[model samples]
Target chain A: MATLEIHDLHVSVEAENGPREILKGVDLTVKQGETHAIMGPNGSGKSTLAYSLAGHPKYTITGGTVTLDGEDVLAMSVDERARAGVFLAMQYPVEVPGVSVSNFLRTSATAIRGEAPKLRTWVKEVKGAMERLNMDPAFAERNVNEGFSGGEKKRHEILQLELLKPKIAILDETDSGLDVDALRQVSEGVNRVRETGEVGTLLITHYTRILRYIKPDFVHVFSGGRIVESGGAELADKLESEGYEAYQTKGGVTA
Target chain B: MADNTPAGSTTDGAIQVGGPQQPIDARVSAPASYDVADFPVPHGREEEWRFTPLERLRGLHDGTAVANGGGVKVEVSAPAGVTVETVGRDDARLGRSGKPVDRVAAQAYTSFEKASVVSIPKDAVLTEPVTISVHGEGGVAFGHQVIEVGAFAEAVVVLDHTGDTTLAANVEFLVGDGAKLTVVSVQDWDATAVHAAQHTALIGRDASFKSVIVTFGGDLVRLHPRVVYGAPGGEAELYGLYFTDKGQHQEHRLFVDHDTPHCRSNVAYKGALQGKDAHAVWIGDVLIRAEAEGTDTYELNRNLVLTDGARVDSVPNLEIETGEIVGAGHASATGRFDDEQLFYLMARGIPADEARRLVVRGFFAELVQQIGIPELEERLIAKIEAELEASVA
Candidate 1:
């Protein structure tokens, strides 16, 4: 089992004016087999937390302590963090030209597993996972996200999440741009991995529609670059009814 | 500066006498000739020689270098029903496709003792490719080769160059009416070698010609591949891939002359440069004459700069004399590695080195696929991987 701990995380980005802090002393903890939904409005620093933990290089960690099973996650490189079982499903997955989906997946699997997967079984494993997401078998031969549609890109991300089976998976806006059907399919994929009981999922989103499918063990209201309230699933229902206006009026800066 | 001095006394006199005296067509100013004296000795000032380093030619441009016999061994292997012969320069079929437009090519034309001619009979389809291997033996050499495909014949030919030598040669392709020909010319020379060659193809009525030029070696290599249509309804496709390493100069200049109506042509060349002082030059010129109506042509050049101090000069020139063409367009781009692409691959647990390799390989994958030969494609991919291994180390 794996556990991730983020304490007093402070992140900043270089804007045109100067250095501007985004994540202001945020704290969170996620253990294996636990699902945590970080709910927030626009510009609430939710995605900043995802990219910072994944070592995006664009985000500067001014002050923070991130540890994965007592190992210093903040000190690791982007790829090193990935090899250490930290996966980030980006909101807008980059388009890598000329690299086929199959090759990318196999290369990633090799790096994570420390050896090449058995060819016969690996092919079947990929085919099975892709089928679960209703992906076409021919999609394996296409370039990774080169010309895929929005829904297709989301499904591809979930496909990787299912196959890689990282210890901690951060899904950033996976529900954005996805239709109702795609949302249900992608959520089903997350739930399937959740049932494995060996992975911790940090699903960051602005809507509570996804929480209806994948129930979160805890709901955290993110405002002003920090979590101002934490509660059970009932809190999500309350936010869905009352909206984030109350928090914004209660001294929570817009960004 | 004495006006009474003899006209041919100074070194610049030769350039003045051989160069175009008056303003001529910008597309092709120098007239094609068979004699070396008709063309000027390039002093790196002419438009064609601006990007080339004349000092590295090893006397190929001027008349100083003599042919050291046996410098290069030419071997030809062909399937049944095909004829391969080493005929003298007087062979009536030689130089029928195009004339020598440069001094080095003209010198090669006049100096080569023997010319290899490969002929395919009419309507004969070749199952196996005709392979011509030119192995350099470390000297100055000149060569000429002719590949003639008869009417309605279909054939594929592979011209492979290797080893070390300062070589200049001319290769001609004659496609008969309704014939289909594909040529794969590879320049995989030694690191210290110098090479200059001109490849010309004359497409016949309703015929098709495809050329894949792959260059990966040689200290200084320059290739000029030109295409001309013999009659209407001809089609030509030119695809090239080159890898320029440290201190290497690889240049590819292409010209497609659409002199006949209803002719179509497409050109695409991609290159990757690595290490310091690595230089790559690509010049694509397409010309559609006044009488050539309904002409369609497009040219594209893309270069991936892999490291610092590497340089790429890509120029695409299109001159259309007729307004009744279907379409004409060109594009050229030279860029370093895409950071977001690298980040995407690395974010999936791939190390930096492997990610770099993937991007470079992906950049050239399109042109490599145009080879249409599985074994050759695999070999080229392996060669690219080996090139990456060096820089990574």
Candidate 2:
């Protein structure tokens, strides 16, 4: 059974000319433990999909049903959807100064788990997770995503995922603005998620850099408000060379 | 040494030595004149006290009919998630010694409007410091403040006295047991205000009290801070900072009483007086009771007169009734800002305003950082910037 199912999802924003459609009926799905990568051009409504799924107040969902493990996901609150195992690693992580990263992650973990744990055990668990992700343990005590480099923000998101252990994680262009070393660290963190049994992922990116480490089981192409084509890993290669022109053609695969 | 002799005393003429060279003039015992009835203030009956112009004291007291009104009333122009409320349900006697604050004297100002208050629930661990502004922009602004730090509770309270223009204000604080409270009060008024405020605290056992007061404005401002340690195992820290420019007069008076055993008290007040005839004073007194065995007491007052015409007078007083106390000491000095700290921040490419802000933040950071509330701390940083602009902008 599919872990996540997106059916005819449409989104728009209230702009000067009225509802300017951003996502024009995109549909896709992923089964349990499978990783799917969505490759798109700029302004292709890629980040919109991530925001709409996370229930950010900015993105308006004009139509669609988003289900996670057969549960209706779109009807939940932002934090509720978060608690329901839908995680979005934001491309531009907000700088929440004064709120320490450790404090934020711990609170998030507690909120997700629905109970409080011992401080000693919580610290140990956090230490172990940071070690697995190669993050400085002191970063946890620093303010949340505040004063962090681009790479550090990405790593901090991964740390949260590790600590919270969400069922399905969405990486919104996490590959952007990363150096080779930072990219490797991030890919390793994602790979750890995949190895932890039954964890589903949706990697949204403009570049295929991260795909080199965490191979996607399926690849979907998004353009002009819809999914133009879907296939195996070769689809990524074909688009890489031909540059999405073939997918724009009228005869392109419409599903 | 002769230097340790009592002020205005003749050591050789004493009929009998009470203890040592220090005069034991029974007639000149420590003055307990701060009681509600006899305390000397501008409320009534005096001429040297005629300095309080009615225009300045306009709304300082309730008319002949009503009891004293207490509560720091503030109607915020912004609808943020903060509200000002009274300290408790008892409406009449909100820390006035039941004397309606009007008859108690020493008030150059009182609230014309009804009093306002804020309450943090019992055992409520409010991580953020609750900032209360006794904002008096134009008219005479007189208000009261009552704070209750519940049992086993911990909180940080920030009171900022400021105005769009010149103004005056009064505030009071009451704290409860096994509870910890830290208050940071910054006064940034227009150059014309004559600000006079008083703070009284009654602390219980196992509780900690901390206060940082920074005074930056007022033509003539006086602060009287009194604290009474009502039980054992209590700790109190008092700190003050004042920067005066151009004919500003700021004074701070402290009275810390260690009435029981195993108590600790410390006081530090520093200031910089600049411009022609600018003046500042630090008057502090710590009292150790007969039963205050194993008590530790310390006091320090330092001042810097920046310009040749500016002046500062600091006085630290300590009276020990028991020899069994572990420590009792006092220090006072009046002097300019640290040129080194300013140069360091400037060399780091920080602009003058930002550098000034950093210096100011660091100067107060010892207490500001101790505030555990993330959101409140952020707001405090912003408030500090706003005050700096008002003063220097």
Candidate 3:
């Protein structure tokens, strides 16, 4: 089983005034098959933590120790982190004009799996995964994420999450632009990967609507730069009705 | 290149092959000649010569460069029912498609010892492509080529250039009535080689002409492709792809003259520049005269600057003298790598360099596929990959 530990993480972004700290002394730990939901209002350093963990060049880690099964995660390159079983489903999927979805998925699979998958079986696997996500088969030939709708882009992200099958899959705001049906389909795709029980999931969102479908074992209420509250699944239901007004102040409350 | 069949029959907003023939009312009787003195020398200040580096011409423009060099070795492979011949300048078929419109072209016309003419007979269909390999044997050389497709014939002609030399030449295409032709001209010269050529074509009544120019190597290369309609219902498509490396300058100037009624033309050119001092230039010009009613045309040019110190100047101009045209438009774009695209690919586990390569390949994929020649397409893709590999090594 994989274990990801982020201890006292401090991250900053280049702002007009200079390096502005976004995540200050935030800590979280997720084990194999664990579903951790990070919920907060806008500008609460939620996405910053996600991007920083993915090693985005825009987000600088001022002080942090991120490890996966005792292996240094912060020291890895973005692609290296992915090869080391870390998957990031970005909030906004990028459009690659000429690279077809099939090619991109194959390349990514090759990179992560350390070898090119057999062509016939890989094609079938892709067809199966796409069918599970309700994606059109024609999408395999179209350029990656180009001209896709908001819901389509989110579904594509989940498509990658299923195809790559990383140890820790981070879905940042995956439900933002999704409709009720699309959200259900995407959550179903994620749960299929979760059923393998070999993957840990970090679900970052602003609403508890998605929780009704993919239940999170742990709920962390993020505020300012760190988590202001931590609890079990019941905490999500509590925040669902109570809102984050109480946690907006400072110093989290334990469950 | 999956479907290498010609594209004119299927394109929308583009003229279809074969229709009723009509008179050419906007034709200009150009002073066709092999005399360099008939054309005035360019001072690099003229509109056509502005972007060209004068000194880089190696005396080809000023009547100083002699054709007494080792010259180029030309080889031709023609299918059955085709003919290839070397004729003197006085051959009746010579200069029928077009004449030298500029000083450099006139100079080339006057300098070449003989011209190679490849002709496809009427109603002939070549199952295999006609290949012509032109390798520079060193020094300054001037040459000319004429590819004539007969009525109701179909053919593909490939002009392959390689080796080193300072060369200038003129090429002409004569598309007969109801004929279809696709010509691919590849300029793969040495790093020190300088090559310039002007390609002219005359589309016949209900005929289709497609030109694909691929330029990859050369210290300095300038090519001008011009097309004019011989009668109504003619069609023309011009496609070009180039890669400019460090200290290299590649320029493509195109002029499509809609001189007849119901004629159509489409132009698309894409280029990539890498390394310090690398430069690329694309000038697309389309003119529809007053008498050319029902004229349809569109042009597009796009460039990718792969590194710092690289520059691209893309200019697309369309002039319409009549309001009776079906369509007229042009576009130009030049940009570097899309960071978000790179990030997306890398986030999926592909290495940074691999992602960059994939992006570049995608940028040119559409145009390359339109070439419709499988072997040539594969070679061009591999060449592009080799170029990217060199940047890191």
For lDDT, the strongest prediction is: 1
Report interface Cα RMSD per prediction: 1.2, 16.5, 1.0
lDDT of 2 by residue, A104-184 (tens): 565566657777657999989888888887888778767555579999989988877777777788899999999999999
For DockQ, the strongest prediction is: 3
Evaluate every candidate with DockQ and list the scores. Answer: 0.50, 0.01, 0.68
Record all residue pairs in model 1 with backbone atoms less than 3 Å apart, i.e. clashing.
none
TM-scores of the candidates are 0.80, 0.49, 0.86
Go through the candidates in order and give each one's C-alpha lDDT. 0.88, 0.65, 0.85
* Ranked by DockQ, top first: 3, 1, 2
Q: Write the per-residue lDDT of candidate 3 for residues B1-393, one digit (tens) a residue.
A: 112111111111222222313212122122435678876777877666777788988899898888876868889999888999999878888877777777788889888878899999999988899999989888889989999999999999999999988889999999999999999999999888888898999999999999999998888899989998999999999999999988898999888988799999999999887778887888887878778999999999877766667767776766677788899888776656555667788888999999878777888988988877788789889888887897632
| Candidate 1 lDDT tens digits, B163-239 | 99988999999999999999999899999989899999999999999999989999999999999999999999999
Best by TM-score: 3
Q: Residue B55 error for model 2, in Å?
A: 14
How well does candidate 1 score on lDDT at residue A22?
Answer: 92
Q: Report, for all candidates in order, the number of backbone clashes.
A: 0, 20, 1
Give the winner by TM-score: 2 or 3.
3
Write model 1 residue lDDT over A1-255, tens digit each, in one string: 699999999999999999999999999999999989999888989999999999988899999799999999999988999999999999999877667899899999999888999999999999999999999999998988978999999999999999889999999989999899999999999999999999999999999999989999999989888988999899999999999988876636753
- Model 3 residue pairs with clashes: A228-A252
- Stretches of candidate 2 off by over 4 Å are A248-255, B1-210, B213-393
